[model samples]
Target: MALLREEDRQYLENLFKENLKDKVKIILFSDKAAGSKLVVPGRVECPYCQQTREILEELVSLSDKLELEIHDFLTDEIIAKKYNVDKIPAILFEKNNNVLGVRYFGIPSGYEFSSLIEDILDISRGETQLSPTTKAFLATVNKPVHIQVFVTPTCPYCPRAVRLAHQFAMENPLITADMIEAIEFPHLAEKYNVTGVPKTIINEKVEIEGAVPENIFLEYFKSALKD
Candidate 1:
């Protein structure tokens, strides 16, 4: 069965027709096996790897400018290391033949799908929807900032946090943002202590529990830089 609805596919086709100005490469790392090498020794599972590949294939079909490259996390260790991908079902976006720091650590389905679309648009345009103030603040960031927003496919507010961090990454090359599906990465969830949805951890230091306003999020981001 197709994961994307017919209506949704049509909508994305139109959206891509109007918005995409440049090529966007979707680099995916996953294990084809039912049990992935990245998982625990006794844990025989790769819950979303197969489904995630299907969704990505459908997505690339929607636009000529969009492309998909699939790789095995275990066997393609060198490529995975180049992208700093250590998890199965991970995705990285590339534009102008330059890979960006934006990524998704699981299947970007449901509400999070919109976030993926917007990210492609932003990368193609080489800009973001952030206000001048936010952009200005991001420009001042000299050091690297890693923003990881934990989410679930069903969460309504998760997209906001994901998009915000991704936009920050779009504005500044020093910032790398990720949308991590908490359910798909249980170990990471426990490591980060993510109990609720839209939990954003900036630089693994500053943490926000819910979707927050841009201004408040900036405050947390700045705090992360201090640590």
Candidate 2:
């Protein structure tokens, strides 16, 4: 059975045709290719890796402008390190060979699917929906800003936080935004004390609970820099 319904596939095809501009490359660092027989040291069992690859494969087939590249996180250690990817089922968006800081560290299903789609569109257009004021502020970011939005697939408000972080990443290469599925990565969720959905951890210091407006998110982003 197809993960995406036929109706959803058709909708995405039409949507990509209308909105996608430049070519967008979808890169995934996963152990899916290794299958169950192979075992690499330090690499744990990835229950969602295969499903994640299947979804991404199905997604890229919708548009000619979209490309998919799958790399084994263990075998392709050098490549993973280059992209700062240390986890399985990690997704990255690339345009013109430039992999911006927009990354997804889990299976983007349920409501998180919208965040993945919008981020791809944003990368294709090489622009973001953030306000001019936000853009101006992003331009001044000389330091690195890591925004990790911990989410669950069922969270209705998670996409808002994820998309905003992704758009901020698109605005500035120094800002790396990641959407982490809390259920899939329970250890991380516990590490960050993610009790609620749409909890955003910036630079491992600033934490924002719930989905807030763009201005409020930016304010939190600014505070993260001060730390």
Candidate 3:
């Protein structure tokens, strides 16, 4: 069974066909034993890695401009450290071989699927749909800003928050945005105290509890930059 329905696949095919202007490389880190029940000693299990790669494989199949690269997180410690990926089922995108700061820390299924596609389109077009004001602000960011938006697959409001953070990353190289599936990484979620959906943490300092308007989010983002 495919993760994406046939009808939805057709829609995305058309979408990517019409919009993609540059090639987008999708990078994934996973283990092969994820889909199996076999136990591997001394290695922590990654439950969703296999399914995540499968969905990405299906996704790249929909568009000629999209590519997928899979890596074993256990054996590829150097590569994982290079990308700062500490978790399994991690995903990131690149264009013209330039890796973006945007990342997905779990399966980009459910509502977040749309966010994934939007990021690809934005990367392919070398542009974002953020307000001009927001883009201008992002360009002036000098310090490293890390934005982590905690979300669940079922949350309807999470995509907006995730998309906004990702677009911010695209606008500025110093900014890194991550979409963390709260249910999958309970330890990090607990550390951050993610009690609700659409919780966004910026610079691991500023926290936004809900999905705020674009301008409102900008205000919070600025606060994160303040000393």
Instruction: Give me the candidate number with maximum TM-score.
Output: 3
Off by over 4 Å in 1: 34-44
Q: Please identify which of the two predictions, 1 or 3, would achieve the higher TM-score against the true structure.
A: 3
lDDT of 2 at 91: 97
* Candidate 3, run of 10 with poorest lDDT: 35-44
Model 2 misplaced regions, further than 4 Å? 33-43
Query: lDDT per model, in order?
Result: 0.88, 0.92, 0.92
Show pairs that collide, candidate 2: none
> Which parts of model 3 are misplaced by more than 4 Å?
none
Q: lDDT tens digits, residues 187-220, model 3?
A: 9999999999999999888999989989999999
- Please write out the lDDT profile of model 2 over residues 80-175, one tens digit for every residue: 999999777899988988999999998999999988998888899888889999999999999999999999999999999999999999999899
Select the stronger candidate by lDDT from 2 and 3: 3
List the pairs of residues colliding in candidate 1. none
Tell me how far the alpha carbon of residue 141 in candidate 2 is from the true structure, in angstroms, after superposition. 0.7
lDDT per residue, candidate 1, 1-227, as tens digits? 78888998999999989988988899998876744455555332568888889888999999999999988787788998988897778989888777888999988988998898889888877778888898988888899899999999999999999999999988877889999999988999999999999999998778999999999998898889995
RMSD (CA, Å), candidate 1 to true, equals 2.8
